[model samples]
Target: SQKIEQNSEALNIQEGKTATLTCNYTNYSPAYLQWYRQDPGRGPVFLLLIRENEKEKRKERLKVTFDTTLKQSLFHITASQPADSATYLCAFNDYKLSFGAGTTVTVRA
Candidate 1:
């Protein structure tokens, strides 16, 4: 079966700095990649999506990069603030969206 993995550990960072997250995949080549932010109890809210051929995509302070050659993706949040803290998920399009475990981020004032 295919698998997508993100660091389960919570990341802590100071305010005004960038927060980076990583997603690794195996056993499949997806058509596109999507990112979302989830609160502790709520469902994930879509952020950005990048195609297999797209090297990078951005929206405001959020940036996403996909590398089919490396079978990995990188997600970045610039000038992070306390409000930016949340669990970030990486999903792939394979007739449907398959999600990773999600990585939590925390920003301190």
Candidate 2:
């Protein structure tokens, strides 16, 4: 069986700082990992995706790193703002899409 886990507690960070979130998985080797942001009552917005062979990927102020050796992924938001505050989710696909519980980020201005 495969399992994914994210930070169980909400993350609180000051505006203009970077926020980092972690996703860990067990018993699965996914081809790629994806990150998404979900605002209250809205569907998740795609952020970044990193492949198993890739070490790192970036898009605008977002960055993602994939480490198949550790079966973990890291999601980063640089110079985060209040608008960036949302529940971030990490998902991966082996045969099917699997998702973490998601970590809520609150960027205080």
Candidate 3:
């Protein structure tokens, strides 16, 4: 079976600092890795996508990865702000996209 694990707890941090979150999995082979941001009850908005062939991909202040050997992916937000507070999800695109529970990030000023 395939499973993904992101931080289930909320991440509280000071504004203007970097936030790092993790995503781990077991018994899964994914073609690509993806990261998304979700606010309150809204659906997840795509942030970045990294292919299995690639080590890393970035957009603006977001970064992501796909490690087949380790069965994990990492996400990072640089110079985070209060406005960046939201739930972060890591997913893998194998056949369909599958997501982790998500980690809520709270940036305080």
Candidate 4:
């Protein structure tokens, strides 16, 4: 069985600082990993996708690094803002896809 875990805490920080969150797992085969952002009751919106062969991925102010050897992924947001406040999720794709419960992030101005 595969399990995905992300910080369940609400990350609060001042605007303009970079926020870093984590995604970890156990018993997962390397295939594909994706990051998404969700606001309130909304569905997750895709942020970045990294493959087993890929080392890292980036988009706009977001960045994702994958370490299959470590069985972990790191997500970073630079120049974060109040508008960036939301829940972040990570998913693992294999025979079936599994997603973390998500971590709430609050950026104060």
Cα TM-score per model: 0.97, 0.96, 0.93, 0.94
lDDT of 1 at 71: 96
Give the candidate order by descending TM-score. 1, 2, 4, 3
Q: Which one is best on lDDT?
A: 1
Instruction: Give candidates' CA RMSD values in order.
Output: 0.8, 1.0, 1.1, 1.1
lDDT (Cα) of model 2? 0.93
lDDT of each: 0.94, 0.93, 0.88, 0.89
Quick one: best TM-score, which candidate?
1
Q: How badly does each model clash, as a count of residue pairs?
A: 0, 0, 0, 0
lDDT of 2 at 6: 96
Candidates, ranked, lDDT: 1, 2, 4, 3
- Give the Cα RMSD of candidate 3: 1.1
Error of 2 at 65 (Å): 0.5
Q: On residues 1-109, what C-alpha lDDT tens digit does candidate 3 reach at each position?
A: 8889998778999989899999998887777888989999899998888888888888888877667789888898999989999999888886688999999999999
Please give the RMSD of candidate 4 to the true structure: 1.1
Clashing residue pairs in candidate 3, if any?
none
